[model samples]
Target: MSKVIVLTGAGGVLCSTLAKALAKEGHKIAVLDLRKDAADAVANDINKEGGKAIGVAANVLKKDSLEEAKNEINNTLGTVDILVNGAGGNHPLGTTSNPHFLKEDLLNKDEGFKTFFDLDSEGIEFVFNLNFIGTLLPTQVFAKDMVGKKGCSILNISSMNAFTPLTKIPAYSGAKAAVSNFTQWLAVHFSKEGIRVNALAPGFFLTDQNRTLLTNNDGKLTARGTTIINQTPMGRFGEPEDLIGTTLWLCSEGASFVTGVVVPIDGGFSAFSGV
Candidate 1:
């Protein structure tokens, strides 16, 4: 059966792939993104491929923006049956250059290094708001349409950092941790209302957000990327397509009883400890 799906950050590398996959499966997709052009491009592609989709400009951090988008989606595609929260990322200001802190390093700070102490409150707040609060506001706005409605589901994008903090991006780690926690909270809160809430904890995929950190300008893996690959038992980074099967199953009737689970789609990165 076809359903109306509102996907935030649909223009992004990962979510765009997911949107196209869902569209191919006959879902009416509302591709919402802060970047209007990107969103429109994805929606147009879906439409050209014989799928129904509409691009909507929306900011997950703002209630008004989300409300406006929701109105447009409802008017154009009918009430949303699935909401995918995929709008979250990290900022350089919230990252540290060194993985571990040293006391002498704090006294003799390198101009190129961004220590934890050097992290800006504004940057931390931005990451937190984008990941945690962003998910909260969209659910608050769209879950209203799902209440008392059968087969309604929500999918949040989390990260492996939510389980074990990675190096450098502390703010993103903390924020995604909150996201995982909130996913469970939402599942339990909405269980009686027939709404299923879950999250996908992706390990590492090369996306625009972390391209610089993972690859150099010449398109070779950096030290961190190499480390991730070596640590992953599968010895590879995941492709966006790698997530489609899990995503489809979760959103489809196959996962009717699955809720509040954070499924990791990393290439076994979460399992190996580099022993």
Candidate 2:
């Protein structure tokens, strides 16, 4: 069945891939992102493929912006049946150089290394809002029309960090944990309305935002990236296409019975124990 889908962060790597895939499946898609150019480009690609897509630029952090985007989507392609909350990422300022810090480092006046003690409150708040509230705001705006609608679903983009807090990114990990919690809460809250809420916890996909952090100029995996691969049971990084199968299944009739679950497309990283 053809459905109207709203995809947040549609300009990003994984979400853009999903938007195209959904469009190819004949869904009317609204590609929303903070960057209008990137969103337009993805929508344009979908149009070139003879698919239906509209691009809308909006900030997920702002409630009004999300409502405006929802209005645009409604005006262009009916009420949204599927919502993918994909607007989230880590900020360098919110990350620490190491997972733990020594007392001396905390007392040091130097600004060379940013330890947990040095992580700024503003940075932490920025990440928390971007990932957690970002998901909530969009859901509040779009789900109003989805209540009691069959085949309505909301998919949140969580991370492996949510299950177990990743090193160097305390804020991101905590925020994603909240997202996972909210997914369960919303799922149960909207169960009677026939709106299911679920989440996808992606492991380490080398997207454009993390490419430099994970790989060197020579295109080889960095030491940290290599460590992630070693810990993963599959011993490899994930590609954007790796998520398409799971995404489609969730959005299709096959996954109608599934809800309030966090599906890990993590190459078994979430299951591995570093012995």
Candidate 3:
């Protein structure tokens, strides 16, 4: 059952692994990213491994860029049967230096120490637009191809923070929460269209996106990273490969009856209560 699948942010760690995994499973992959070289590299690897894939450079935030990508995808790989919205990330401006608000921090601010009051609108907006709008625009452009088509689905990348907001990154948490809500709304909206919509909420994976915050330059886990491992029942950071099984199942016929569900791929992170 080889189907055309478009993965936005395929240049990223998680999605790149997913693109390769899906392609290895015989799906035609459109490895799309803002970086042309990153997308091309992933696609090239897939093609070299005898998988069908094409690299396409596209901006998730720009409708015109996405439209252009859709055209290329349609012409080259055929209509998209599956779309994985993987284009969202957090920005430093959207984060606070400390998890809890402190008066001294605001009163005597140190260099590079940003508090809640220091959260810039521009940074917050960037996070929101990247996670929420990024997901919406791609669906608006690509889901049309899945309309009335059998065995079509859209998988959004969410975060465990969506269920329970983690410390510091407010904008990323809120945007991901919106993504979870949108997943439910989309599934209902497209229920009669033969298109399924769902989302995956990953807990803690050490990708380049969060590498600085999670791990120190010396290759040791930071305080925050250590805290995450302690919190996660699995006691370790998730590998990119950890998401593959659930991702494949959600995209497969086994999940035909499942839609509008935000599946937590975290290893007991969502279920645990730190006692």
Which number leads on lDDT?
3
Candidate 1 Cα deviation (angstroms), residue 87:
0.2
Give each model's whole-structure lDDT. Answer: 0.93, 0.92, 0.94
Clash number for candidate 2: 0
Which ten contiguous residues of candidate 1 have the minimum total lDDT? Answer: 104-113
* Ranking 1 against 2 by TM-score, winner: 1
For candidate 1, lDDT tens digit of each residue in 57-169? 99999999999999999999999899999999998889987899988777865676778888989999999999999999999999899977888999999999999999889
Q: Write the per-residue lDDT of candidate 2 for residues 108-175, one digit (tens) a residue.
A: 66665798867889999999999999999999999998986899999999999989998889999999
Top-down lDDT ranking: 3, 1, 2
Looking at candidate 3, the ten consecutive residues that score lowest on lDDT are 102-111
Q: Quote the lDDT for 261 in model 2.
A: 97
Model 3 misplaced regions, further than 4 Å: none
TM-score of each: 0.98, 0.97, 0.98
- In model 2, the runs with Cα more than 4 Å from the true position are 107-112
| Candidate 3 structure quality by residue, lDDT tens digits, 1-275 | 99999999999999999999999899999999999999999999999999999999999999999999999999998999999999999999999999998778868657878889899999999999999999999999999999878999999999998999999999999999999999999999999997999999998998888999889999899999989989999888889999999899999999999999999988899888987
